[model samples]
Target: MSERIPVFKPYIGVDTAKAAVDALDLGWLGMGSYVRDFEARLGSVLGVEGERVVAVNTGTSALHLAMLSLGIGPGDEVITPSFNNIGDFQAIRQAGAEPVFCDIDEETLGIDVEKAEALISPRTKALIGMDYAGIPCRLDALQEMAARHQLKVIHDAAHALGSRLHGRSMAAYGDITIFSFDPVKIITSIDGGALVVETATQVEALHRYRLLGMDQSARRMYTNERAWTYDVADRGFRYHLANLHASIGLSQLELLSAFIETRRDACRRYAALLAGVEGLRLPATDFTDVAPFIYYVRIAGGRRDDVIRSLSEAGIDTGIHWIPGHNFTLLKTCRRGDLSVTERVGREILTMPLHSFMPAST
Candidate 1:
């Protein structure tokens, strides 16, 4: 059989395994010192204050808490792109807010700020922008638009951990910025994510919110202690990241620079190899400030299905980045504007194999 090229394979090494073993030896596997350590390291990487980064169990939890922290709730509306993962939509709905889907820019494939601005209303509380395929949405323009309308901006930086815009890190924008460390992401903490709050007060609230509303629970966790008697100030959830997962995240952080270079190189290689292939539309290869998470191409001439089948037969795996949220039964009833670009992209987008661990021979 020919060597299989899967959609993605995480870069795992001896250092990652050793870090997990170290956490195992520590015996306190809950949200302990290691989680704090990971958060501090991540803060350094993003150039944010260490205490401002709140580590969570998943990126969805981060988004959910972010909306709630910003006081978005029932009867409020948040604008987002339909060319995004369903998690953002679910997070808005979970916070009792409506998600107003917008279209994407044909070139960058990121949210269309002009379309989002048109959809805003008195009830629009915030705007959520995703870094699609590691290319950041025009955050400055979006933030300016939000400011003019007195709305908050939340950045779903799930695909943009190591990406940069105008020499600043992706986390430097938005009222709140979030990251994902799922297995297929640029880095993995086994399964973990984080939210970056701008103010100390908000950070404190996020710390408590992630630990089931127990006030100052993060301080206790850092010292390997728990509060036997605690008071719930407001609503919260058990969403804090565990030490075991954070340990793995720390290991991944150590290799982030190399991982980014490898992925960027692979993406460039794919662009070079697949350029001018019939019916394939490739993204621009200007990755000077971006760390791409996926290598995607647009299949024109209604040949996406045939291309996928051919690749499968050759032991190569592929995928679609997303299906528009409006297509989902659960979210079909939500408010939305014109999704022409979103629908078009959904039909043509195809994700090919790209990862840091691929064989150099390829």
Candidate 2:
């Protein structure tokens, strides 16, 4: 059998291993200096104030915290694209809010702003816009609509950490942005995420929320110290990112630029190679402005499953980025607008193997 090609792989190496070992050797593993360092470095990369960035255990935690910080609760509703990951929907539910499903634009595979606007009602409190496959959503429009309607916006940038919009980092534009550093993401901390907000007050709330509502100062924690005299005032979770994972994240952060460049090159190659193939629709962008996560193609004529089987038999793995939130039984009864584009795209989208520093032969 030929060597199997994975749909996603972390670019781990000796340096990453050494970083983990060194972090272990430090004897301070939980939410310590390394986590602080990771958040600082990530903030610098995103051109945001370090204090505004809060590290969490996973992308979903970041979403949940963002929802909590924004005061979304049982009576509130958050508009989100149904053609999105389950994490986003669960996060909304975790905050005791209902997720109002919206449609996506066929071009960007992002929320259709017009459709989303129509879904807004008196109960609507927020909107969650995610970047599909590292392609940015219509952020400016989303922000404008949110402001006009007096609603908060959460930018689910799980797949777009290094992606840019109009030459600015996606983090720079959104009201509140969350990034995933999962094993299969553009960068990995094994399993971690970060939230970037606009104010120190918001940061303080996230800090308390991520660390079990403790009023302990993060400054002391960064030096690997803890205060037993802290107070807990509100609901919180054990969502803090540990030093072990943050150490890996810091190492991975050092190579993000290179990883993004190589991934973009691979995506360009895929687009070029797959062009003119029958019964397929490729991504619309040229990938210059995007970080290029998983390169996907829409297989027509109900042949997506057949193509997946063929690829698996050839020792090449493929993936379905998502199954669409509305199709799930839990979300089936959620309020929604026209999901025509989402339902069609959900059935057709197929992600190909993509990784950093991919060899030419791959």
Candidate 3:
């Protein structure tokens, strides 16, 4: 029997472990200097200012904070792809806004601009576009649509840490964008995320939203201090990233380029190895622009299930990218536009084993 190839895995080593130990040795583990330094490092990678970044405990928290920063709330509607992690929908709902599910582009596996445009109404406040499986959405087109409709754009770039589109950073688009550092994402901070803002104002708002609306808490924490006497101007959450998590993130960020190369090579390898496999269709590769988090293939002719079973027996693991959000019981009654692409993709897309640490032969 061979080793079981996981659908996703984190690349960790002595450096990462040492980072965690170093944080513990500091004797302070909350959202402090390490978190600030992580945000600064991430900002440098994004070619943005450190003040424009807000580190959070989870990618979902980043999404929720981004929405809240934009003042999206009850009676507001946010258009987003139905074929995405449930966290996307939950984030919108968590902001007291309604998620208006939209269809996805079959090629990009992201929100279809045409379908999203058709669903817009007077109540629409924003659009959330996820970079599904680390492939960036047609962001320029989406941005144009948002401008025309007066809607804010939030790029849910949870899987797009090292990805780009047309040589521009994935985080460089949209009004606000968030990246994930979860165990299964492009990089792991042992569970952390960060939101990128376009303006100093949104940065401040996000800083407050993630720290229980405690004004200046983020800035204070950056100096290894706290807001002992502060004002809570608005609603917020205790969603700030901790020093321990940031330590891991810093270690991982240092090795991000190498991780990107490995993942990119793995994706290309999969494309070559599975090129002639029947009933399997791989996405067109654009290594120059995409830093894929998962190498998913579209299985056709009803062989998806059988292929998964065979892979399982062969010590390989597989997963479905998602089930359409509209199909969920809780969201079944929610408003939705044409989900034709979302429905079809949901049935055919299978996430295969593709990770930074994966063996070349895998």
Task: For residue 351, give model 2's deviation from the true position in Å.
Answer: 0.6
> Tens digit of lDDT per residue, candidate 1, span 1-362?
87888898988899999999999999999999999999999999998888889999999999999999999999999999988898899999999999988999987788899999999888999998899889888899999999999999999999999999989998899999999999999999989889998898998899888888888667887877787887888888999999899999999998898889888888888888888898888886567788999989999888899999999998999999998888999888764668888898899999999888566676
Query: Over the stretch 312-349, how does candidate 3's per-residue lDDT look in tens digits?
Result: 99999999988888888889856565788778888899
* Local error of candidate 1 at residue 332 (angstroms): 1.3
Give TM-scores for every candidate, taking all chains together and pairing residue i with residue i: 0.98, 0.99, 0.97
For residues 138-196, could you state the per-residue lDDT of candidate 2 as single tens digits? 99999998899998889999999888897899887667899999999999999999999
lDDT of 1 at 122: 87
Best candidate according to TM-score: 2
Candidate number achieving the greatest lDDT relative to the actual structure? 2
**Candidate 1, after superposition: displacement of residue 55 in Å?**
0.3
Q: How does candidate 1 score on lDDT?
A: 0.90
